[model samples]
Target: MDKSVELLKLGSKIRELRMAKGLSQAKLGAIVFKDQQSIHKVETGEFNPTYIYLLEICEGLDITISELLDFKK
Candidate 1:
């Protein structure tokens, strides 16, 4: 699959998990020390984040990196 497509899928998974956890973008962003707009860009797959950012996102979501990348649904 294309990288952009992969990013979008990952973003969708992140959004799903975030919603399931009852978290708003601002809340998640706060946990990760990012702005809400940054979270929005990430969830929309409009920004490619660094590995550290991904780790921070996982931490914010209270999920493992494997869980974050497990787009199996």
Candidate 2:
């Protein structure tokens, strides 16, 4: 798979999980100490985040990295 496509899928997963948790981008960003714009970029696949950044998002989502990347649906 292409790297951009992978990122887009990851972003979609993050958005899905965030919505499931009833958190807005700003709410999740506040929990993770990121700005809403940054969260928006990630959710829109406009930014490639670092490993730690992903971990931070998982933390804000109250999910493990495993859960975040499972994509088993």
Off by over 4 Å in 2: none
- CA lDDT for candidate 2: 0.92
Model 1: which ten-residue window has the lowest total lDDT? 1-10
- Name the candidate that leads on lDDT: 2
Distance from true location, Cα of 70 in model 1, Å: 0.7
Residue pairs with backbone overlap in model 2: none
Query: Candidate 1 clash total?
Result: 0
Looking at model 1, the pairs that clash are none
Worst 10 residues of 2 by lDDT: 64-73
State the displacement of the C-alpha of residue 12, model 2, in Å, after optimal TM-score superposition: 0.4
